[model samples]
Target chain A: MPNSETMAGTSAAHSEAMIGLYDVHKSFGPLEVLKGISFEVPRGGVVALIGPSGSGKSTILRCVNLLETPNAGTIKVGAQTLAFSKRHRLPGDRRLADFRARTGMVFQSFNLFPHKSVIENVMAGPLIVKRMARDEARAIAERLLARVGLAEKAEAAPARLSGGQRQRVAIARAMAMEPDVMLFDEPTSALDPELVAEVLAVIRGLADDNMTMLLATHEMAFARDVADRVVFMRDGVVVEDGPARQVIETPQHPATQAFLAHFHRR
Target chain B: MSGVSYHWDFSFLWGYRTVLLTGLAYTMAYTVGTILLGLVIGLVAGLMRMSRNPFIRGPAFAYIEIFRCTPLLVQIVWFYYAFPILIGIEMSATTAAVLVLSLYTGSFYAEIFRGGILSLELGQWDAARAVGMRQGQLMRHIILPQAVRRMMPPFINQSVIQLKNTSLVSTIAVTDLLYQGMLITAATYRPLEVYTLIAAIYFVVLFPLTALGQYVENRLRYAE
Candidate 1:
């Protein structure tokens, strides 16, 4: 019950939500990406959202940051509800840039700026978004890179790093933003099986530090191992949500059990 | 006699070396200036063509299409002569050359820049967005820098073309290198020797640029 209480408390914090979505809908011509997607993430907790491919998990994550405009919805991040629609006429809002300043994301493909060294990539957020002094950002970037065990590779271009190392650098880039919460969009899904362990380890370290996180991933084992709560999604709706152990072990919903059965085998 | 005599005097080019040298400087200055301006306009226009809003998107696409369909020489002349006639504004031959050259090169540069940025793995855009970046941030931070590595060759190539197009400015009396060469040929009786010297100077200037382009292509490929 305390777990549900925690979730409710997390949801209640939506009065000035760190991130919130309500009745969001998105369509690309005839292809619908989000169908009334609604959820909220509070200040500090790890919420793992699992769903089938094309279930709009990534879209939902993107909409939170206004990367993808939803056709109809209200998204609030930290007392500010972003306006997103197919036809709204506001352009070049620098405040939106500032809002994203306090939020960061680790991507599935480790989108490190290929031209920049690992440290430069890490420094990009603070330098560009936060307007931190270059030298200061560089110093802190090295520390963040070190935190992810990439200190030696600070001067290395991301192309020179291995898949896992690049993803860790991507994580460091996000962390350097000093965000309130970090969003991860399948951060390890692109890695080789062996490399996944290293990425998962860096992520585990972030969890250990009690950083608030929202991850959309299919790594059920990872969900069970690190996630505080698991949300099973189907057809763009949350089907079942509970503690990782219970949800993965004795899923009540038919969809959840079926999903776990497939997940357990592999 | 034509083969043996060569009907050429080299003295004219040597005497007018100052004219040729000044023309060369203007050529390079014109090329470098337009290439940078063209690249900036192309970068913005290319992204605008991809914009989400139709109002923002349509004009960029239309502008690029119209310019791309028109010949550079015609555009140059149009800007040089017709522009003043149509718009009641007069620009000098040099100014007109630079303005038309930038617009002409910008349309082609837009294609190269857009293609380079687009060639990036689709996941790059997704990754940028997931970090809470707007399209501008995504372009400036993620896409532009990465695209640049692939873009250097074509961008440099456009500059080279801009350099070559400087010859076209001679028609408008801009006194570019090619025009100066022609002027020397007219004043001097030795067409063979004067034209040969001009060709050598042009080769001297262009060969290094072409080599640099090749070097850049190799470096970017190796980085990948």
Candidate 2:
């Protein structure tokens, strides 16, 4: 077991947590959002962050990439660790860019570069940030598009795609970056009810591949089925963290129960 | 004919062909030069206007505000007359016209650039940053492509307006189309015919440009 631990450490994102957030605090002027929140996602772990609206779930997801710099906290992603003090400046531009390259994010609205074709959106990160060769980047993009079942849409614009298709393309775009960890901020929340299944299926496939992921989502049933662990947060604090099945079936906190009740009404 | 002239003469224009042609070319050259230089200034000013640093943003704000509030005609006259006097360095009429028009057009374009950028949803910025794109890459790849599409129609409209405004340079005796036309009218003592010909030339030039503007607008139209 000791030998295995060292072996795992050598492999990229093997046993150690790929992401860690400790005592993270965030505020927007007069309003406070995340208050001393802490969590960890082990290599290949799928952690689902479920919470009510304005519960700081999305804010937490944003902080992982420094899109919304935390008011205070320590964050670690992959092998890089960032510590924040009361007056800590944001990481230097070069450092932040490097941190971002290691992490991929999908958004609720897809945010696919609307002007670019489907293949271009997926290839953009590798081509621009990674400075990948055109042919090499194109091949990677083609592979990812095929994986998402959007190979035919490679030449299509994001505006022409349906909601489900757009989100799938967004997923493919993120995956093309070969990030060590992926973040989904309500990836399916913006999709229509009938269209939600397609996006969920892509995410499920990602889970099966053992890709480390942190998702802020409202798909309770999917979370129960796919997540290794569930983190229930409300009012900027974790209410319960446990196995997905246990948390969904038998939540310990009243707030979690109340929140779950709203979802279960359907 | 409708107002006073019972007869219109086309013979006068034949003698002044070279003067008119030269003026037209000068007008076009000045317009193109102003557009290129103005766009550069606008892009830099627009980014500065959005900067978080007050030092950069303040001067940019002042430039946009001052130029926008004053009339283009007044700015041209002031630059032509006062700039050299104040700086103690003389500039030709053509040089002053180009400088004034470039700055004036740039002020309008700064607003166009700023608005196009601000109109993008915050989600796009967040998504781009999440992918770890640097500020420059984000703008070149994500922000500008989308923003430029929105900018094109207005930009075309501005181009048309600026082209017409190029005639203002004639007032400073730059020997542009309108100025040449004025000289022809004074010499011929046939103001009606000369002015009518000038109007026709402007219409002929501007009509095609307006059509091209519309074509660009339709081509770049984004799907909802």
Candidate 3:
């Protein structure tokens, strides 16, 4: 029952797990993406899911937000719990929406609403979903824009921004919701090489603020530096899960070692 | 072939100016009314076409396909001539024309709406949902704002065709512009000048609309 106020100043040692997935299984037609995946992100924790492509890292992040429904297992975020199986049905849209509202997600593509100005995109969830007053929403949006270093670009359309700038706006948009947990599905993967650091810096700032996050990223060094824990997956199962430095630097599993080898090659 | 020219005189039709103007008014009225009604139908049917329920999707599919595949003239005639007989109510030619034309235009507009919505990348939906917006709110605020921009060119294209399709009302004995031209031709016996004037009037009205569509397309293109 940890709240954001209590969670904010705490470190990853906080006893409560903010997000929990137990034996989560998801399949897309014939291709099974998540096979009995289980994990937890403790309150004020930053856990990074690192693996090569098709290792279900993105799928795991998506499932936690209910973006991709799991075929079998339980997902608990905040106070809401959803169990999916043959006998158990996915929650109704309203409940699922309520569940998702507690968690914010940022996509690889930086899907900013193209028609809206930067501020409007950030304000949309509050203004439209929460039915917050316009002035209040604008205040929150402006603060978030400033936080992401995009305050001056607030009036510009999303189509007009650079890739890094757009991703920053996306992070701001997600933050405006003030969700208990944040999900980043390859946030920097779509950015230019020069732009990746700026986006990652914003994420690093969030980690410093003690925001609970589960990110699936290819940025190995950032994960090792910013994330409190790392879960290494390959072929839809966790191969290694431990402290960020140990899992990335020293590996007990040969599979994990071989995977890290590719990134280590000079 | 001999180069023979008949006398061109529009003086006789000057007396029928009021009638032609009234006819033009009817044409404009039907176009405006039907386009508005058609848009409502289009929005509803278009969303329904995307529904997951078979019951909802099936009927929308039938309505769009049945109207779109048939000729407008045939639909106008059937509604005026055949529909009333089946319904056991005597419908006025005006009522039948409006109803038939709106439904006809709606089918095309539905496809345009659907295509415009689908044309957006899947990331748009994903992003909106990530923000916790419901289906209706997402479509209204996020999806539609972007989709409407993509839909503008095709929407205008369909609406232009809708203005021309209003001409089909003449077959149902509605006094739209073309029907007035027939009356003028019958009275003045100058089919050549009368029909020419009618074609010129239609051209004058529709040319600007197509130009506006092109302008909008360009603006949207540059906007991206």
Scored against the true structure, residue B208 in model 1 reaches a CA lDDT of 95
Cand. 1 TM to true fold: 0.87
Higher TM-score: candidate 1 or 2?
A: 2
Residue B110, model 2, lDDT: 94
True contacts kept of 2: 0.76
Candidate 2, B131-155: lDDT as tens digits: 7799898988899888887888899
Q: Give all candidates' CA lDDT scores.
A: 0.80, 0.88, 0.89
List model 3 lDDT by residue over B60-173, tens digit each: 999999999999888988899899999899999989998998999999889989999999999999988888988888899988887888999999998889988898898878
Q: What is the lDDT of residue A258 in candidate 1?
A: 87
TM-score of the A chain in candidate 3?
0.93
RMSD of each: 3.7, 4.6, 4.4
Please give each candidate's TM-score.
0.87, 0.93, 0.95
Cα lDDT of model 1 by residue, A108-147, tens digit: 8787877778888888778776778999999899888888
lDDT per residue as tens, model 3, A1-266: 11112223324432367888777898999999887877788888999999889999999988999988899988878766678898987677887778888899999999998888999999999998899999999999999999999999989988889999999999999999999999999999988899999999999999999999999998899999999988888888877788899988997678889999999994
Error of 3 at A114 (Å): 0.8
Clashing pairs in 3: none
- For every model in order, the TM-score on chain A comes to 0.90, 0.93, 0.93
